[model samples]
Target chain A: MPEQNFPQGTDRRPFADGDGRGTRSDHQARPQGVTTVRRWSNWSLAALVVGVAGGTAALARTIPSHAASTTTTVVPTAGTTGAAAGTTGAAPASGTTGATTAPGASSAAPSAPKPIAVTSPSGVTTYVMPGTASGTAAGTPAGGVAGTGGTTYVARGDT
Target chain B: MTARTRTSAPALPDAWQDRGDGGPIGVAERPAIGTTARLAAWPAERLHDGAAAVDTVLDALDRQASRFRPDSELSQVQRSSGTVFLVSDGFAEVLDAALRAARWTGGLVDPTVGAALQALGYDRDFAAIDQDAPGAVPQGVPAPGWSVVALGGRLLERPAGVLLDLGATAKGLGADRAAAAAFRAAGGSGGVLVSLGGDLSVVGAPPRGGWPVAVVEDPDRADAPPSQVVRLGEGALATSSARCRTWRRGGRRLHHLVDPRTGDPAEGPWRTATVAARNCLTANAASTAVMVGGADGARWLEETGLPARLVSTDGSVHLFGGWPRSDEAPVDVSAGPSLSLAAASVGCRR
Candidate 1:
């Protein structure tokens, strides 16, 4: 439903593929246009350009990922691999999972984030797009008090 | 409501002795060049060793519990290879998990599709397999279901030649093991966290606050910074879905998360589901099972009383039982404040 805007140069699909960058038109700005760079001395100028490019590149990089992530909030997750599907570690003695959000959220419905599934045990994952991570699952711990059979989420040292 | 009291210091084996050995949550803490009386606690460098630890468990699983392993205990007892053998105990831990999950999802999370998965596409270890030549996907391969296998405490037998795929359950168990190791090594008196892939659990409060975690939307963006943050203290969380994996064979796209009923990758209303429990094993297993449950899966999760969040295929989030959104400030309140809050929030979830 949200895909109809197409923003600028997006290829029209059934939905906004959830890539999060809004539309594709904003994609090819060559990194430097979003911000301005006064050409400094030759060495300084080149450094400035690269630095500026690098920063923009970083921003540009996060933009789509964030966009895609935001979109993924709505996407089904199980065995799909791409974007967030990247793996953090092999099945481990030292594995770490994705970031943890808190419990008892104040009901705010912003756009959702979609995620890909990654099998850390093998370090190999199949992503939707070739470059994303593949993660297997996301956990949302319900709050308002631990119930029977459900282990209560206690803060460290509270017990 | 029953309250299980705990006050014992966690104990662990030698693998986590180093001062820096707690596990990762999302961007796993990787080891840095150190003057080592202690080792790095990061996730990458530990791959082989970690995999070895996990494989050690799996190998034993096959030897003791699997019906597919030719030389495993279950395998040896079977009258012949033609018979699908199902047995219990060690190997049954994984099977029991799969069976419980299958019942939870109404068979969407069946673990018996190993053979059909291979026949349709994925046959070898993910690392060793070659991609299929792109083409039309053939239809209707019956997924091998857990239903095909029968089991009890130490009893299990399956249909002849039922290849088993423990992909889902294995990860959860591995995460629990890894995190438990870290928690124990951390002395069980301080903050600790462990995460394998996206499955995670926390044992302490992070320096910034409760561990500020992010549930990544796409696996590709895994290394990319997380967008949503979670304030984790002492719990586990896992997300399950199939929004990636675009391998084509038989002229069709085949993804993972195969529906045991259809024997093909799932086509469901929900795309991702994250289940949070006391440990990664429960969270991981439950998340995988919810994928199999579809819409009803969420309701079932609510009743079972696990806190959960489900993202639908059409792009909707179904927050069941009011999962506490971990985006708030990681303020380190006093023990009194924490205890008071804990006491208050407890009855609320019910």
Candidate 2:
């Protein structure tokens, strides 16, 4: 029997998406909201401001009554919730007012996403979310494309 | 060799030792699971801790997954072959990785080749195998296919005669795990690189220029100079070749890479395939599958968009998916092995 070939690069996808149990359509359907939020989070502030403007204009035309009273809350973009909040301003139909902010942002700007230490099932590999330093010393800035550091040889074949 | 029956954490082997003096980048090397395990960490101070963490991971993997060890969890599963049995978490995790690789490559790099390998006279470790041994008549016992092995939660079920050899994916997974462990041990601040028999993975922040690696055709040949040196900032790099790990059977030279379809050593156009991926396991899987897929493998690799270097059996080189050009220019992140966009064009050609 021929083997089933999944979409390539599934290795880097989230555990849920890469588990081989879900189809591409299933992924698109299940993560629709989360995907939108993640996409918004990756946008630049300029692009986001333009998006907000366009969204507010659309809302004004669609729901004039709510638009007058609805204040567009510009949640600082950084954390997961911040990204989710960034999209809420455009969603007047949901009854979310500009006064409301992301759950943690109510006190102050949401802090940068903390690096969560994720260990593999076997306890062999651990992936620390990029950006933040938890219990250790201050984290150094991530580097760019690999450049010549020193010569380390990698041979063919599994030794 | 007595099989270690203890399922719990096994003691670190005495062979684990540091190599070379403390330098800008600390390096340690030790014998592990029939291969040499090497670890390099930035900020020399973290070397000791990183080495310790790597040692722990490698040892645990050997105890949990070594097929040659009669006491390993994999051996236990094989002993109870064909029945539904509960597997330890570590064993299950490794098996999951193996199965995933098989699925990704469409069984070209399957784990169910244990019986085929044994029939090819590769039942023992490479070091212990007699290269001169007479070959048995080729049984052409094709692998039962990875689909036969079922793993759910902790319960695994497979037919009685299906044996699994995790050799293809286990080491790559080990490198990933060891690198992660080493990075965590270093307080998750500096960078760590773990190479298990040349399949290497990097984690945490890299140095100013990323990790420099010299890609070689055959690591077994000490005199073999590097073909190319590429700096890897993130993820991992792996090479698979049919030129190494060979034994003579009935005067026929055979390699260890078995083609599941034919139950014979893969005889593809490419003798060696090297790929850079977001992780070591993915890289290893692609490289191995390329060796088995031959010319078609090159096409498959291009579709995946992971930077790959394929050396044909005639010694001609073919670069695909934005692999570093001969000019040695820095890899263009936009065009080079972008893991996010890799799936954009992947499909089954056959």
Candidate 3:
């Protein structure tokens, strides 16, 4: 694949009907009597906007929990030490789904139970440390190209 | 914390922590990505192989996305003033993730705050930065914001002043990618879990009891006690703390988790926010956003029904949705030489 580029300002779309000239001419051709009709139309539009806005407010007020609260019981294996011991009485939670904002909601987050504090397991944290690299670029590897479109999406390999 | 001078690849063998005791499950830890990376898997013998595979992906991503590295692709993009640039697939994915997070949070987690971070004295690795370094003079110019970025496939168009930073999502994304790579290379048996700092991701089949993760308020402080332990059957968990990676500026303490809207550290009563989701990326975004969202964070988590645990500035703990209760006994995740690998290899019956 070859790299492609778009000139700046391409994100803006041009007007239809020959670049706005035809649309302007059509607007000018409207009959003068239509001005009164336009006023009535504007009032009707305002009423519709208010109605929709009110309905949206009502919908926002409803709090919905789509999933039934399912709990998993965690049992501690005997002889477990440190924080792992505290896992015995803990309840497993249903995984997270994406969230959308609700209007007029309280700014502070709702509170839940306080978590038990346990020391970091000495067994895991005791591992020997390794040396760190300053940093390096992943320049095109043997299987991938640099800037050319020849690059393959390795990250999505399993997906 | 500022960037610590990158040393060299971790020493072989000795550098790999062996938490295995002839058990079916093997655990290993290595220092990488400016933090500790822990990998857990079944079949103890293959643990090192999995870690190596993950390192390949992470090392590449670090080079591409790290802002601390002058030669990184991100730094190059920042230097492309008013010009269009081409990016690697990995770099593009990082940018895409950051963009999606901003959009999902309504620009609450915007990546355009690179300049804001630099202005706050976070230009280098956390370890290299001076806590009492002279405060930065605000450029008076705000970020160009995420809207002005035009990313059409691999081609990226910058509006001259905008700076791109992947700090918000890179670690979690790396964890996800590393876990996937490790699992794929680990053969058909066992599961793989990778933790880069506090961000975690898992792939493949889990052990009979699932992986046990300790939720801690401050990840930077390895000595700080864990607040809770939860079994992750599958998916990721990420915790962001406003208390960590902080420095004193003009007698006021500041942290690295910057709020793009104000070009300043987020003002919230909560000191740390931890969230669990289907992947590390989403979990990280939600955690960071919640830290900045202040009082609104809990409501958003509740409305979304995402299980989360938060620690307030005064050291109070709060849970939302179905986050595991703190009172429950923690599951045993210890690995021994004799633990049965059959659970991962032969497949355990539910």
Candidate 4:
């Protein structure tokens, strides 16, 4: 078998955990890196001062500086709350009985995108509701086209 | 094929009349990608430029992936069966994607249905397909299967009689590509949403309240009211319906969503299944698979945790994966609103 070089920093998981950003779950195990940022900032300033005194501007450019720390915060939106409460206009039409929730869905409005199964009149189970998360599939290696970023979707049938 | 013949005038419904009305973003529409495409972008000034970028990508994909065109790269591969043929990067990517899809769905979404589609009188463009004529009986030949084809990097080798049909997957891939390109063309400072025949992708930052998309049962049904309207900050949504692209074969109604197991059109309980995935391609695949899997499809989607919305043949609606339930009354087929205006605007030049 040809060796598949799974790209670094790409989520190769079979299912999308969330918005395709990272595998980090809803709960963070550790706090944001405030001390790390301070340390890096001090080191960079010291290096710049030394380089400038030595008149080696080129050396300063080549020296590695720790990346600036960035923090991301996730906030609940009105759409989510309204949909969970079944009050949003976007929700399924009410009084249109026979809608079934997925097995994994929470009773409360779903915080993460979850799969839904809807059965038909023939009693044949036949539906999965889509979610709003993006670029969450296991990464498809870059090849064959110009643009990259986003997950791949495929469908087939038994006929 | 020439550009004129490539993109025919869009035949869209009047239901699109008030979509995105008064939204802060600018929207542009054009007849391309074998369907009407809408590009909604922030910073209204970049809307036209973003649409143009999408058009370029779609046009190139059309040339490389159009199975109907004898000169297309995919056609060349079909004709060059039994030999290793060097294909375009786009063709290779699509084929690779098809193979991956087959593996992903465990052969549920096979690309080997090309012959089956052709046998069903879908040999030409959908417009040129003879819907009234009876479809031919399939030869009972299972597609060579995805395993028979080998991809050595960019080179592809397929046995003779192994025809490939990208269909929904190609459209999904194209939508993903177009959406990403359009977003980048806007200097990545604005959000961009690309909808190709209802299979869409949203990238960058979405407008306030997110991108409002009305999901309906039959996209071709001008009289059909939207089953639901959902917002998307980013991601993709696709609807696959047995009710559309339909024809009569021996007085029996048949549609394009085929089952690879029988080499014939699929007959399922669900009239339409819409799926939302991290990307357009997966959403299209899941939606189409739901058609073949029928009741089993519901279980599979649930197990996989993919969100979806499905409408049954009896017009009973179903929702899962956080798909909201609307307060609006159920769609009354007999009393559903009609296309009040025949001349609905589909192409909006920025």
lDDT of the candidates, in the order given: 0.45, 0.61, 0.58, 0.56
Candidate 2: Cα lDDT at A137:
16
Q: Candidate 3 versus the native: TM-score?
A: 0.65
Q: Clash pairs of candidate 2? A: A147-B209, B135-B250
Clash tally for model 3:
41
**Interface root-mean-square deviation (Å) of every model:** 17.9, 19.6, 14.5, 13.8
Residue B173 error, candidate 1, Å: 1.7
lDDT of 3 at B160: 68
lDDT per residue (tens digit) for residues B116-202 in model 3: 877877777777767785554434235567877756556566666577767767777777888888887778456777887768877
* Docking quality category of candidate 4 according to DockQ thresholds: incorrect
TM per candidate: 0.51, 0.64, 0.65, 0.63
Candidate 1, residue A70: how far the Cα is off, in Å:
34
CA deviation > 4 Å runs, candidate 3: A1-159, B1-15, B19-22, B134-142, B220-223, B327-350
Q: Which scores better on lDDT, 1 or 4?
A: 4
DockQ per candidate, 2 decimals: 0.01, 0.01, 0.03, 0.03
Per residue, candidate 1 scores C-alpha lDDT tens digits across B1-350 of 00121123122222233232123311222210010011112232332233223323322332343333343443344434444333333454555666665655566566676666676667543433455666557565676667777654434556666766665665565455455445444344333455555666554433222444566556565476653444444566677776644467766666666767777676768777776676666666667667765656666676666666677877666655445333322211111101011111111110
- What shift in Å separates residue B54 of candidate 3 from its native position after superposition? 0.8
